[model samples]
Target: MTRYKIGVVGCGFFGSSLARELAAHPRFELAMLCDRDFERAKDVAAEFSATPTDDHDAVAADPELALVVVATPNHAHAEPAIAALEHGKAVFVEKPLAVELVDAQNMIASADASGSPLMVGHIMRMMPGVRRLADLLASGELGEVAAIETSRSRWIDTDGADPQWWKLDKSRTGGELTHEIHELDLMCWLGGEVTAVSSIATADDGFRNTVVSFAGGAIGRHTISTRSHTSSWELTVDAAEGSVHADFHTGRVSRLRGGRVEESWPIFDVDAENQSLIDSASRTQKYNSGNGGSSLWMQAAIRHEIDEMAAVLDGKADSGSPLTYARERALVVAEQVRLGGGEPAALSGSAK
Candidate 1:
């Protein structure tokens, strides 16, 4: 039984969570933890008896590390990822792939030339309910998708450390449109290729609405904002057969027929503890167990991806997430260039 040595770069919020997940992974062990913040890196590294280093080059340069998870901030994704791929290590990059078009393409090219597997972490694709929704869409139970729409809105106090400020610069996070590229990838998977998209963004607030045209003639409309007082995440897909609406937080699903709600899936009841996949079709969800109250649902999605990556390494399966996630990132960058002249929300009382 051979185990893959996994190194995690950038042990911040998501990075630390991924470190914990990788440490517990059966086939992969957390070999190293890296962060410019030395103390934080040491804290997470202790969990798995992994060594901690501040040197990004050391993590990439290690041939013993079979996989490196690039959980760095958005702007930081490209370098460590490309370096690891170049060193012949498989790479797992946290979502929004990269903040810039050229960086995204270069990451993909580096992986291609190195023959190391590249996977983008789109947490939504890991959700049980979302995967079920995708299943129904592809099952033809929904017939041809006529339209697909989604909304993601959240409000932060912005008074404390103000992490939103990390994302305030489009260079660091890629404005709201680019930030929602995961949803866009889901849109492409559920419907088809998005042949064209026209979007309008509000002032510096990060509110955006985009009208999407699909190659299959199906349409998509998206409204995404990080400025709202009320938080939400909902998605609905309409098709010739029926429609399915999902509440991302609860994993509640609803079936619609004749433009009226036919039934609401008791996903919460089925997954009483708010765990497990309500729909049985989810092979990914069915096998994975709990994380001991660490984080539910979305965290489960991350573990699912980790396991899939292990399978890819074992030659039991092909790559996990599609390369199109990388391509769509390029497309988002192009669209943002056309729709731009917008700036990220300014950090309060900071130097202008």
Candidate 2:
């Protein structure tokens, strides 16, 4: 097996977790861990026997690095990713592509100019349950997808949150729309390209919703609420024949017809699925809390995504360009601005 040398920028929760997983992968050699917080980088690097550096530029410039994984904060993704891509390294960007459309486009353009393999980290697509759901849709068992409704809602207490908490900043996280973009991306992947985004609404309590129309004639409603008393992460596809639902909180996917479950399966292996169910029963949030890592199935999904990137770098066919995901995301962002009383024309450089 040809091993790839990997450098990860942002040694925070997601970056550290990904670095740990990559260290365990047979086809990956953890080469570098970079973060502005040098101590954090050193801690993660020590675990993997990898070099630690605070300089992101050093990772991109390192001749020994073969792949650069940008797991930085939502808005900070572009610079490191583009730098790595320009240096001719295969780059994997943790999703939303970028907080801003221009940055996202620039990242893609850099990859194109450098002939580097660029992939977005949309781990939801690799989830076993989601994969099965995709398979069912593709096989025509679920029929043509007519609509997709997704929600990831949890209470985010900002009363005493640290001022440095990046997620609290709409500019950095792009609110829930880009921050919790897994649902939107999954909706587009299953329902097809976004043709129109009809409405986008937000509330003072951190509730956001967007109504989108797909080119394939499917309608989608994506929602995210940090004000909810109940926490949930789920997506349901209503198709011509039946419906399929994936409950991330429980790590289960079900196929239904005539208002009954026709088939059901774990989103991951049995142990992981059971763990998710147990965790969900006691959890207050659907996503990672503080510096904690993601759930078991989510970690597994990341591993699958790494393998996909490896395959793509090995000259195999890619699932799709990261640009496609970024473009779809930009459409939703544009709509949000238009509906929020901001000029749609601002989208050209709005996020910049």
Candidate 3:
């Protein structure tokens, strides 16, 4: 098997985690780590046995780097991704694709022209529960999903903090576009393309909450804030036969049918024999399985995506097309923010 050299741009939590994981994967070598903060990038690079640099162009220019992961702040996603693709590297980008639709379209076009695969880290779509739900929906077990509701909220201590942060800025992080777009993507993936959306948003103390309606008559409500103490997400789908609820935070699933209810505990031991369609269709690849304390759910999703990308690279699998759909869903969320009538704020501070 050919080992791929991977470069990571951004030394934040997500980027650092991915770097460490890639370093451990036997199929990938962490070739470089980049960050605006030289010290932070150097620290992460040291941990992964990779060179640390403040210059993204150096990483993109590296002949050994076959893949690049852009984990930078929301506003910083486009340039590095485009640069890496232009330099002939496959790319994995954290969500929202880009802050603006135009940037997102450009990124997509670059990947198309470069003939290099581009994947968006809408990680929730890789979740076991989500995959199971998709399977159920496809099998018609739910019998026509009538409506879907999802919420993601977390409170971060930002007292006396800068109010013009990327996460709060409508122009950069795009508020819900960074955080809750996963839910939007999941809703659309399980439901259908959202033809239209109407939303209401509130911005105060650097937080926003919005509710939206999708095309297939499915409604979605979202709350994203840096002011909550706990991170919680739940998705409920109402169907003709009954309803299914999944507490994404806990990885628990509940079902109601004919007034009888049952709850399923987390399936920690993924059934090795029963491979999902996504799994079976994915390319085979070995990943550095790191320190092993990371969340199993997260590991599974990352592995699935890595495998899918490997397949695409190997010409044994189709390019992961869901990213385009995820992008469309993000557009709807962006429109929701636009129609919601929130106060305009300049982009400042890091998106993290």
Candidate 4:
């Protein structure tokens, strides 16, 4: 198998983790690491046995780099992504895609113009439990999904945070856009497209909550709060026949149907290898969190993205464009929250 050359921008937690994972994949060549903090970049570069530079343009200009992973802070996604695309590199960008709707549009438009594969990191769809739930819904095993409820909350101690915090800056991180867009995308992926949204966001208390109506006549409610005492991530789907629950943190799936309940944990299975790769890819692509079972599964997805891009470069694979659509829906939800008054306007796509 031919290895794809990769450049990584940003040396933060998520970026460094991805760089390390990519470096371990024989199918990928870690070509360069870029960050404004030169020292940080050098450290991550050393881990991957790659060059480190403070210059974004140098990474973008590398002829050997076929893919660039943009894991910078929320505000900085667009420029490097656009630059990489213009320099003929496919890109995998960390989520919210961009902090602003206009920037997200620009990135999408640039990807369209460049004819390069673009993928956003909406990792929930990649989780094994979530994927199993989605598969159940698709198979009619859940007997028609009626609604989806998702919750994510974590305590925030300002005293423990660095002075240069980016998450608190609404303009940069887009708060819920950064934190809960994963749920929004997963809801869309599991239920259907969101037709309209009505939301109430609390800026003073570090909380965001929204109710969304999907085109498939399903309703979704999301709660994202940073003031909670403990972090909780959960997704539940209630249907006519029964309900499915996914604990994102533990990768557990529980199903209740016809007065009987069943539960399962994601296990390593060679027979389910391809599906496992898709599930793992979705997780790393979105969450950047290591897989609970084996890091190899998550690494496989990262390598898969690189391989897919290499395939696109070699005219052997179709561009994975669903990710762009997912990015668009995430932006719509962000805009709804930003509007913050009266009912949200009708979403672009049909619900059913």
Judging by lDDT against the true structure, name the best candidate: 2
Q: Pick the candidate with the highest TM-score.
A: 2
Clashes of 2: 0
Model 2: per-residue lDDT, tens digit, 1-352? Answer: 7999999999888888888888988889999999999998899899988899999899999999899999989889989988898899988888878777668777777877898877788777876667778878889877788889988887865565667778768788876667777777877667765556655445473776777776678888878777788877889999989999988777678889888999888877668555765475346653324577667656777788877777777876444533223333444444454455232332221111
- Give one digit per residue, the lDDT tens place, for model 3 in 1-352: 8788889999886787677667777778888999999999988888877899999999889998898999887778999999999998888888767767667777877887898877788877766666666667668876877787776565544454456544445556665445457766666566655554545445453455555555556655555554555565677788888888777544466777876675453423374312432242232221222123444445666776666555655656543344333454555456546655332222111110
lDDT of 2 at 231: 79
Model 4: residues with Cα > 4 Å off, grouped in runs: 140-143, 267-325, 341-352
**TM-score result, candidate 4:** 0.80
Model 3 clash pairs are 24-288, 25-287, 25-288, 154-228, 155-227, 155-228, 156-226
lDDT of 1 by residue, 261-336 (tens): 8877643333643444332212222112212343454457677778767776776654324422333433442354
Residue-pair clash count for candidate 1: 0
lDDT of 4 by residue, 1-352 (tens): 6778889998887787778777876777888999999998898788778999998889889998888989888889999999999987888887767887678778877887887767777755554455567777879866867899888776644554444566556666776545457776776667666677777766574676778877778988888776766666778889998988776555456787765676665522333543554454333222223223445555554444444445555656433333444565756766777776334444432121
Write down the TM-score of every candidate.
Answer: 0.81, 0.87, 0.77, 0.80
Better of 1 and 3 by TM-score: 1
Prediction 3 TM-score vs. true: 0.77
The better-scoring model by TM-score among 3 and 4 is 4
Model 1, position 247, has a per-residue lDDT of 70
Clashes of each: 0, 0, 7, 8
